[model samples]
Target: MTRIFPRPLTAAFAATAALSLAACAYNETLGRNQFLIVDDAALTQQSDAAWAEALRTQPTSRDAAANERVRRVGGRIVQAAGLTNRSWDYAVFVSNSPNAFVLPSGKIGVTTGLLGLVRNDDQLAAVLGHEVGHVVARHAAERYSTTALSSVAISGVQSVAGDYAKAAGAIGGLGAQLGVLLPFSRNHELEADRLGVDYMQRAGYRPSESIALWRIMAGQRQGSTPEFASTHPSDASRIAALEQYIASQGWS
Candidate 1:
C-alpha cells in the first residue's frame, strides 16, 4: 500500500536503528562502529571468484621476477597487518595503467605499469599497504551494507510520494550520497592511508615514501574531481593528511 512506505530519510534512519545491535559492530582497530550486514567470509568468497575471473580473462605476465617482487613486499605487509592467517597470492597483470588492488581473499594484483612507476620497494610497500588496509578495515562489507540500505530507502521514497515520487526519490538518493555514502568512501580512503603508513612503518619501510608515491600519482592525474562529489580524496588533501599523520607518529 502507498501508506505503508515511510518517508525516504525517515525509513532509512528507522531501518538503521533496527539494523543496529546485530548489524552495527564496533571495530576497535578503526575506533568506530560500522553497519555491516555482510561478513568477511562472504566477501572472501566473492573476491575469490572475481580473482579467478580476472586471472582467466586478463593478460597476466609470466615475468617471474615481477611476481616474486610483489610476493615479497606483499608478504611483509600482510605480516605487518597480522593478516597472515590466509595464504596470499600475487600476480602481475600486463597493463600500462599504474594500478594495483587486493582482494579480501588475500589475493593481490599489480599492473606492470605500477611496478615501473614505483621508485623503490618502500613506495611499492606504501601502495600495497593501502590496499591491504582496505581488507583489514573491512571497507568492502561496510560499503555493501550502506548501498543495500540506501536502495531500500530510495524505493520507499518512490512508493510513497505519488506524483512527486520521482523528484522525492532523486532528493533521497542525493541526500544519501552527500550525507552517508560519499563521506564514508572518502573516510575509508583516509583511514586506509593512515593504516597503510602504520603498516609501512612496522614492515621497516620508510613511511615518507608513501607521501612520495601519492605525489607521483597526483602528477599523473591532471584535474581531479572535487572532494565533496568524489569518492576518493584529492591528492593534495591525501598528501596533507598523510603528512600530518606521519608526523604525529614521529616518523620521518
Candidate 2:
C-alpha cells in the first residue's frame, strides 16, 4: 500500500501539468503569462463576498472628508486603469496602520492613517493607483493560483510519505504557511509600482509625487520583517525602483 501511495506523487505531477496546460494565459498589460486557474467571474464572486464580510466586521470611518477623498482619488485611478466599467466602492477603515487594499470586485478600503499620511491629493492618488494596478494586473487571481499549486504540491509530497505524513506536523504547518501567508514576489511589487505610476501619470496626477510618497513611507518606517521573509520589497528598494521608473518616463 505504501508503494501504491508513492505512485500518487507521479499522478499529482501529471495533474499539475494538466492544470497548467489550460491555465497559462498571456496578459498583454503585464507583458507576461500568468498561471491562473480561477476565471474572473469566479474570482469576482469570491471577492465580493469577502468585501462584504470586511465591511460588516471592520470598524469603518464615517469622516465624510476622508471617505470622499478616497472615492474621488480612487475613481480617477480606476478610470485611468480602464477598470471603471465596474461599480467601485471605497471605504475608510478606522485604523492606525497606513495601508490600503483593493478587492478584485472593485472595492477599495483605506485606513484613516493613510489619509492622515498623504500630503496632498497627488500622493493619495499614488497609493490608489498602485492598488488599482494590482487589480488591472489580475494579481489576486494569480496569487490564488499560486496558493492552489502549493497545496497540490504539498498533497503530492504527503501521498508519497504515506504514514509518515501523519507524523510531520512541522511539514504540514509549513505547507499552510506557504499556501496562505506568503506575500507576493518582489517582482510583482515592482511591476505594480511601474503600472501604478503609469496610471498616475495618465490620470494627470504628478508622477513625481509617487516618488515623494514612497520616500515619505520609507522615512516613516521604523522596522519591519526582513525583506527576504516579507511579502513586500524593502522600502528603500521600492522607493528606488519607483524613482527609476518615474525618471524613465521623464515625468518630473
Q: Model 1: clashing residue pairs?
A: none
Please, what is the whole-model Cα lDDT of each candidate in the order they appear?
A: 0.90, 0.84
- The TM-score values for the models, in the order shown, are 0.92, 0.90
Off-target runs (Cα >4 Å) in candidate 2 are 1-6, 166-184
* Number of the top TM-score candidate: 1
Which residue runs of candidate 1 sit more than 4 Å off their true CA positions?
A: 1-13
Cand. 1 Cα-lDDT = 0.90
Candidate 2 structure quality by residue, lDDT tens digits, 1-252:
354445687888789889888899999999999999997667888888998999899999989988988888888898899987899999999999999998888889999999899999999998999888888888888888877876787777777675798555457657556444454566677788889899989999998898889888888988887876777888889888888888887887
lDDT of 2: 0.84
